[model samples]
Target: MDKNIIVSWMEAGMIQVPNLLMQKYKQIGLDEKELTLLLQILSFIETGNEFPTPEQLAERMTISSGECSGVLRKLVQMQFLSIEEGVSEDGIRFEKYSMSPLWIRLADELKFEKKQSDLKLTLLEEHDLYSLFEQEFGRPLSPMECENLAMWLDEDGQDPVIIKAALREAVLAGKLSFRYIDRILFNWKKNGVKTLEQARMQGIQFRQKTKQPTQPTTGTSSKTIPFYNWLEP
Candidate 1:
């Protein structure tokens, strides 16, 4: 409502608090008072005051200067904050509060959380793939079979969908064995069949070249099997 007051506010500028810090302060073990104090220090630093005294910071916060001092010490001890000594052009030593450590810790926390989430997703995918294999075979996979599956995923970097397609090809060809599935995957990879559509097209082309028409099954439900013999030359 007041133009002069708005102008003054605009001229005073503002301090930037990281969105990550607001979202993850509690996760990083910072309480309300501690967070407020850190914000005060950030404000001072933004205004060219790199090293504000505890009394100056406390004046803008709800806590007393003594409490501010204690919190600052605690932050330093936790490696979330640090005081670094620097020399000015006049060769005078001065101490400044550095928030680099806090930023580093927050970055590390984010990385750790992402790594954990990826690990969980990978484990879930692995479980589902194993279940699919076991259901298709109608038996629990042996330890060696499980290891091979893991190798295909982790070592060979095989796409899970591609592996599923290979398995389906093996089943349709009436050759449901790991060795056969492995050969199918190998041939698909060698021929640059990365996607399910590409693999299907390749199978169709191979069948057409050999003049093998899919035989229709007579039952309540009819099924067409597109079988490709990967082991054949």
Candidate 2:
């Protein structure tokens, strides 16, 4: 390896992944999934010699024990680990798991993109709407919220069209709050606003009327009612 080229890549990272390392990885005994995980394991080890536990791997991949096992077996077979090593999240090498020199060297060359790609696999494979909602809300979505959201997608009765219209209204208004959607749904239900066409028409009417300023009329008909603001209450 040319020292100048090596220096250039190393400058890009605390440690750099080399094309030669990738070429060497190609000769390893592993399938695609194992290959990818191998690269990740190598990256961490290369960067810091950090070995993640199978449980952590499962969470990261959103995979089952059996699936993680299959991948782990390949790692062990390919000499990524000879023994199952256990370590807490903190950096400690309390146990020994037999791993290959190539794996170690490859790990040193690991990059963030590989780790992030593994995480993206979990996101794409899992039904994370529940967790996503929890993350946004700072609390888990309630069973009622789940049911309500589900109802929006149900194919069986209750016009899916109406639900779509409501979704569009929220999107167009740049107001995606469940509270606002709930209010729209509530008023729609009360007023028998069942179809998308009906809701859209109502939405248009609302836009038109809100854009129109209130006229100052005389007589006792004009009354400034306090406490009309929901946020104030």
Candidate 3:
């Protein structure tokens, strides 16, 4: 409706509240009242009032000036807010509120959460890789085998998908040994075969180059067995 109200609202402007602050306020130990107070302080700062009095802040809040003062003290004590003193251009001293500490704390919290999420995903991938290996090998891995698998993951930094592709290559060649799989993985790594599709294409090219017309040995069929020899250059 009203044109004058709309103009007044437009002139009043808006305050910016970060999504992260809204989502993580409780986790960071801020209650609803404290969060509202922080937003009010931010709104005042945006409107050219960096240091609003408790009574002024209370005018737009449900809390009284006394409660507002107590919350402001708590915020300062918790390092979420700071008041810095400065001399004006007229040589008069003044105090202004700073929200830098709150922002820094929120940034640290986000970083810590991301690190935890990454760690969980890595652990899950490692577990799935181990299970796949045991299923293919038809037995639980020995301590030495487990260590080698971990080395391939943690030290060599091999992708779990590429490792699985290597295992499949060994199985297809009818040479289902860990040594053969390791050799395939090593060759694939040396040739920069980092994905399952790349490994398959490389295998096809190697077999084509090495294809030969074979004379079957005695008691063997004439059909040639197709296998890429990873051990050979």
lDDT of each: 0.88, 0.59, 0.89
**Superposed model 3: Cα runs more than 4 Å off:** 64-67, 82-95, 212-226
After superposition, the stretches of candidate 1 with alpha carbons farther than 4 Å from their true spots are 87-92, 154-159, 187-228
Residue-level lDDT for 167 in candidate 1: 88
lDDT for each residue of candidate 2 in 1-233, tens digit (9 for 90 to 100): 89999999977455355675556564444455665665556555665546566665666565675788778876666556666456667865465444455556466546544788867864453335445545655687788977876664453234445655655566667666666665666666667887778888888876665555455677645444431111221
Q: TM-score of model 3 relative to the true fold? A: 0.77
lDDT, candidate 1, 148-210, per-residue tens: 999999998998888888888788778989999999889998999899899888767766755
Candidate 3, overall lDDT? 0.89
Q: Tell me the deviation in Å of residue 200 in model 3.
A: 3.9
Off by over 4 Å in 2: 1-145, 151-158, 216-233
Winner by TM-score between candidate 3 and candidate 2? 3
Would you give me the overall lDDT of model 2? 0.59
